[model samples]
Target: MLDAMIDDDHTAVRASTQDGTYPRPQLLRSAWTDLCGTWSFAYDDADEGIASGWSSAGVSERDIVVPFPPESSASGVGDTGMHRVVWYSRDLTTADLAGAGHAAGRRLLLNFGAVDYRCDVWVDGQLAGSHEGGHTPFALDITGSAREGARIVVRAEDDPLDISQPRGKQDWREHPHAIWYHRTTGIWQPVWLESVPAVHITALRWTADPRAGIVTADIELSVRPTTGTEATISLSFDGRELAAVSAVATDRETTVVIPIAELRNGQSYEELLWSPENPRLLDAEVRVGDDVVYSYLGIRTAHVARGRFWLNDRPYYVRSVLNQGYWPESHLAAPSAEALRDEAELIRSLGFNATRVHQKFEDPRFLLAADQLGLLVWGEAPGTYTFTPTAIERTTREWLEVVRRDMSHPSIVTWVPLNESWGVQHIAADPRMQHFARSLVSLTKALDPTRPVVSNDGWEQVDTDVVAIHDYEWRPDVVRQRYATDADIRRLIDSVGPAGRALILSGDVSEAPVMLTEFGGISFDTSAADGAWGYSSATSPDDFAERFEGLMAAVHASEALAGFCYTQLADTLQETNGLVTDERTPKIPVDRIRAAIVGHHAN
Candidate 1:
């Protein structure tokens, strides 16, 4: 474990020997320890670990990486089978606890970035806490349970074949097929520990309004502070101080509003607004007593108006790529913090201003990179296959958690709750499914009204601000004919979509902003995969380059389209239709692909 600090600029100022990236990028503290690396692991095939008191003892039979699931090769236990019950244990000494920082008045908290399905945490043979939902993060306070020779243990249970669960791309089949891959059963993200004051901020959210020239922060504390306890929030840009505001806390929650005088006093607000071209971020420092948390926010606003996607009150074209966020060795977990940063840079290098994080809630570190690199994100969740009471309960619970966990990121401009009608397959005809989709949109908007909410991203749209469609038609002429004019786009919206389903379930959205959200999945690589397939296939690199350029030309020439998202950024398992290989090697020249994507290629 290594300790790090957040500099005055709200960037991580790490020790020279620090190897891991900070887990929580938005909220930063000076004293924290990375609890990643090796941990004693075991498989409870017979479900006997809990009954046998495994949580109170060590499972030293096998060693597994802390954040990577046992299913991934990076975990050092490349077993992709159905291990519903998995146990992890690690030992920590008093000296190890002291490594976090001064410990006299501070309480120790254990945090997990994410764990699949459900898990329970135990510290020093006592149940510290438990959490559900695989893709969202949670923390547990172990102040009273920590001592010398502290033993930390975890128990995770996930049913791989449960179609009712939001499994995402994790295939339930014996082998990878179609678009599904292997399962990620247990702890597949970073775990860490930090020392915090008895009364500390538990959550922080920043909202930026460039038009209003103000930024608001909502702070949640561990407990209500005493009288006269004040919270100070300071904002700065490029190391120059902007505004500092203070508030007296009367409850566990408080709000601070800092109005930027420069934006209102004739200063060029364009220089401060966040966009793909200029990802201007305002650094902030929040202090309450001895608790200080550093954070940052991008001043921007995104919405849909007059049949166009608008950023900072101006129409902005969304050139996006569908990102699965999977790696060959690490599965859902990124190989390293540097890898997450590189992934964002890779997407930007392909001339995409945005990325639709397909079917998974990505790492916060990746979102941080997007914020810094000026990439817009469409936050989506894994959809369950079946539509049942259990499925609805699980999906709703988890989707809300995902939105709440990620809505603060300025890079994220949209919230996609359902995609291609996975859980609500009969949404077009079933009123219940339609209602479910609509309710998700309403709930998401209730939590966050700053961004648009796509009720169903691909098709079968129940209620969506963006008219998103998925068309794999490879012919450039036909693609041109489909969206050549506003009338053609309206007719297509009222008709059956490319997936052979109604584009809209009940709404009259002929005037909403239209986007080709999924298209051009042209498979060009077959060297690594035996039965690799895509929506369309090309024989060679030149063929691929031509096909890609043609499809993109039609999309870029559309008079009715507000944006487009190519499917996808890279290949995954049997789905080899990617601009780049699974390892992120561009099949065609990077410049050639970028030219086509940006509409600068010489057709």
Candidate 2:
């Protein structure tokens, strides 16, 4: 139903990246085949698959849908128990490869949007590749082994009780409890195959400096180019050519800076600048050898200026909601690409310009939706529950990959490396934890200096650009009085915060941009489940509206705050504190909820 609300251009982009279509929006190629359907699945709980030669002679215990975890109902294999090792096998016909444009001189690449924890890919009984990290994309070249009737076998190992791994809100318990939801094990995203030339483009990155009229294009190739190999990059907007540049590529990677004359005009450049008000995207066509990539970029910048969040060099208010990005049916994997686009539109309809993708590196399709719909995003990494060397190493390694994979998206305005000190719980006095947090912030900044980085969000902050606090004071008067002035906010910052921990464990955040990142989690579910709850509760719809309006009014009128993010966008499992239900139906009317968010009156 939300699809009808999207405009013609947005609808076009949404339709192109639908489920079983192109999963990667940042770097898209036409020659691709969706590998999402029924796959033979088996659980290797006894961990005897490797010794039993399951990869060579695949096991078929049951059939499960590709891209949905076995723990989810959508997968048709709703096994929620602890099955550390799971195997998936699918046969690819020669027709599939040929349809994907595979040829003699081309490379046939198997890609996974994401597979939880760790996985090993076997093509026709030969190990093709292996990847760790549940939240990032990976590809394997199966050109040599993949043939007619080739059997592709995948084994995924995800320890359900591994608190050291960054699992986000996935409950380590056998059953869902509290705010944590059911586990998402094994392949929880799209799987596809792509064919390209041997020396094809592997990755594409875009960095836009709207004020300088320059856009930097970094292109990575499958292999280093020959002596005279060249790459051409063309940029266009609204059916008009803006800039084009070609450069010789002798190495695997090549960087080109193209200046757009239209973006240089001080008076009319605003038309081209990307913002929540104008989500104009510049089209890009990149060519390297016989390979081509179709991509796009938004000319925008995000920074903190004078203790205020600035977008495109102008101060902007961030009305955001904490979106955990969960579904009752599919868990982490979205029901469809159309559902992801509809999500952004729904958030925008409620009058929020941004969403804090809480505790998870969301699917790229959601980020694509945010980009297309002018909805800002705060990209965050899923946190580990325990602090250990493995935890630190794993968190750091995956966080870097997350940043690199998503840095080019203009919708992401901030990067939160740590949240609520999940892994580094004793960061207040532990030097190692503090150092790790600081290092994550520094590393994020080193990688992407364009966006503000939150070293640790919520409380126990060390060094952060945004002083984000999570205060769920249900009393509207207390909320209004606490953040009513600069002095009050500073006092709260210096002392214990709403989360009962020191807001600032180390720095002088006197000048940092302040925001109430989390609050107003009022539970009001008419058909509440057994464990459904919230930080606060409202009895009826009228009571819910009153409490929501009161808290929002105080937050919106606060002069000391740069922005605020409500507890959630939609209900996630037992967490019934969402503006909308898990089905995405607003508990209150859409217009009234929008009025509460933007300080406007409902008709």
Candidate 3:
């Protein structure tokens, strides 16, 4: 039989006003508990009904850890290829749910931080629920299904290369090389249980309009009891009470708008705003009868007008890095909260104001850290290289998941659905792809019009708020020919006229921001090939440094370029062209890169 691994000791929940608190619903802790660390795991080829009878098949010979999927080393089941389905079974006692103020009879909710592709939950051998999207969190209310000491079994099946789902950066073909890695299957994040009242707030979404000096809040309830109830939504900015509005909550959504001027001590104009440099957050409290939900919101506004991106109605340059959020040990999941925080801090230390989460949707801890640290985030859906209708639906579903799960984070400034036309073939001509991109953009705008949405990051620019491009002039000759002479660079900029391309680069050049979404990828190796120095690899450290300096010089000199993100933050497997190594260790010391970008090294 598979050896059962014990769960981690629950950390004491402490409330802090400064940092260390997740920017989620206040009742999140008491309502949900993290089920991270070991559980009995097994794999089988039998039908789904046989999940409960793992012992009968003699499949208990080896154990796989829970939360961390079998493919990840962190899960203690390293590199299980895509040939088999993985099963995770664990026994949960009532004692496991005991803690400060937690009582019995509350609904026992099993929350999966994330399970790839598809997953099903079985309680006491009864199917409880199932989820489709792999990158978003899902929960099963295993209340009555659990006996006194019932065994809860979770079965997850992921066909990483199935070409029917949204598999971002995952190449399932044998040994993945170049821009792809091993497929992450089953539970790859924390799996835990939480107890909540039958009638409780399901989720909370906050949208801030810094220009209007108002914040609109939508509080959703899980269960709708007969007869509507009057709920109070309170807003506080920097400890000062903002507004307390009463709204009726039925079986549907409840919204309350609070003006910034009414909640602040002074006029709305006097209130502080949230930005990349200084992210100021306001505390919030929601109450339905005695049940209270707590959360925070940052006062910031993001928009694209003319041809520029604005933060709080001012032109702001979004210098950023492409963060893939992959680790050697954890794969998709970060090893710990500190690991997430370290990445944010490292990115900030590099003098960049933002980070574009390249392909994958990161864990909530990463988003929490970004919120607290005041970093701007461009969240993107995981892309599939190939195109299909099933893939399109999967992408749309995952995109919805991203917006719903990450809507409240103030750090998230933009939503990118399609990147580099990975799955979008013939974007302009293909009605389906165009419709999908336009729908996603509209959905993003309707959901949170406070921020801009990029329908497609590069190539065929659609009706997005911004015209973004990813130009990797990897070859030195291309770089020299484009920018070596001032006249050539000027001509290039002029060709992209003021209203370049219709917001096709044709938007107001002065107002609408033109972003070189991806550029400056110079790779360096101690023992490098002779010709690899130019386009793909740098011969020596000096060559890499020189190329980086030159790229930044041209970027700083260009007035048309509102912002640019260095090709990547770190190298991934064979993609050695990154500012930092795969392990997140800086390849070209942080100070040196910062000096070239932000210090005296100029155009």
The lDDT for every candidate, in the order shown, is 0.86, 0.88, 0.69
Ranking by lDDT: 2, 1, 3
Tens-place lDDT per residue, model 3, 7-38, is 13332122213233232322354444455656
TM-score of each: 0.96, 0.96, 0.88
Q: Total clashing residue pairs per candidate?
A: 0, 0, 20
For residues 166-197, could you state the per-residue lDDT of candidate 2 as single tens digits?
99999999988888988888898899898999
lDDT of 2: 0.88
- The deviation in Å at residue 185 for candidate 1 is 0.9
Q: Which ten residues in a row have the lowest lDDT in candidate 3?
A: 1-10
Deviating ranges (above 4 Å) for candidate 2: 1-20, 600-603
Rank all candidate structures by their TM-score, best first, as comma-separated numbers: 2, 1, 3
The numbered model that scores best in lDDT is 2
Q: What is candidate 3's local distance difference test score?
A: 0.69
Q: Write the per-residue lDDT of candidate 1 for residues 1-603, one digit (tens) a residue.
A: 224343455553322122237798877777677889999999999999878989899688899987998999999999988889899999886666876674777899988999998999998889999998988899899988767788999999998888999988889887888889889988999998888999899899988877788899999999999998899998887666789999998789998888988778555877778788888888778998779887788888999988988888888888999999999899889999999889999999999999999999999889888988899999998999999999999999999987877778889999999999999988878889999999999999888999998889888887799999999999999999999998898887777777788888866575579999999999987466967989889998899989999999998888888899999999987889989998999999999989888883211
